[model samples]
Target: MNRKSIAVDMDEVLADTFKKIVKTANDICNLSLSEVDVKGNRIWDFINKEQAKELRKAINTPGFFRDLEVIDSAVFAVKELSKHYDIYIATAAMEAPNSFHDKYEWLMEHFPFLDPRYFIFCGNKKVVHADYLIDDTVSQLDAFTGEGILFKANHNENTVTNHIQVDSWNEVLTLFSSLRVV
Candidate 1:
């Protein structure tokens, strides 16, 4: 069977960006916010506009993307998905200049199972060719040519898009494992 190409996003889908942002907010700006409080694509939506500014600035910091806790079940689920698919880490790191190297290194450290050759760092998701694209950003999903899997993220709770929504890695595993496509 020809393997399907699966393009996965890096930030929220795999990197647990919300947790990092919250930590940064609390650590640097002394702002307390929880996962449920992050309700939109913009940082200001969930935080004090001033503190959100700080969080935004923190993201652009060179090493900010390097260390973050891995989301639950993502590593195992992707490992399993890679077995029957050509999995690629398609991250839109260009928008975040400082994140380029940090994101790459982070992936290298956390998801050592994925071959480095499959890592795609770009400004646009539409340029990527894949059978599926799993991302938290709705705009990326809108641009993808193939099926989009909207990975659940606190920032995107109210996002309404024409994509299949998977709340957890278990759902992804079930969806792919039960596939009969050849």
Candidate 2:
């Protein structure tokens, strides 16, 4: 099989970013929010603009990135995919400049095996080129010409149209294998 380039979104797909954000928000605001409640909802859904700003501030607290965790099967999946494709981390994160940098730093600290060149920070991923784009956003899926595999999670149910949806990283590996032959 020829080597193909794959682009992957960072936050939800690769790292448990949303989870940490919610936990930070709840801790800061003294609010009780379950993971189920935050799933499938946009950032604005649970918190207002002001609250969102506060959440971003909370993330800046020392050791936040050090404590961050990877999603289930993410490390193994990336390790396996690296053998066949040049994996790039493409993320849309300009909304909060500081947080974006923090997230990037966090990613680099955790996944040092990934080449720094492959880590791209963009406001719009639609302009990036790759044989495959693995993302959780439905709107982002529409922007790429290559096969867009929607990484299934809560709050992203609107992505059911015109895209391949995989509930697990193992399934993602299978999808790529199938695509390689086609």
Q: Best candidate, TM-score-wise?
A: 1
TM-score of 2: 0.85
lDDT of 1 by residue, 1-182 (tens): 67888999988888887787777777877667666665665556556777766777788899988987788899999898988899999999887788988999999998999999999999879999999999998888998899999998887887888799999889989988777475
Worst 10 residues of 1 by lDDT: 37-46
TM-score (C-alpha, index-matched) for candidate 1 = 0.90
For lDDT, the strongest prediction is: 1
Q: Model 1 segments beyond 4 Å from truth?
A: 40-42, 46-53
TM-score of each: 0.90, 0.85
Clashes of each: 0, 2
Q: In model 2, which range of ten residues has the least summed lDDT?
A: 93-102
Please list the C-alpha lDDT of all candidates, in the order they appear: 0.85, 0.78
**Model 1 residue 40 distance off true place after TM-score fit, in angstroms:** 5.5
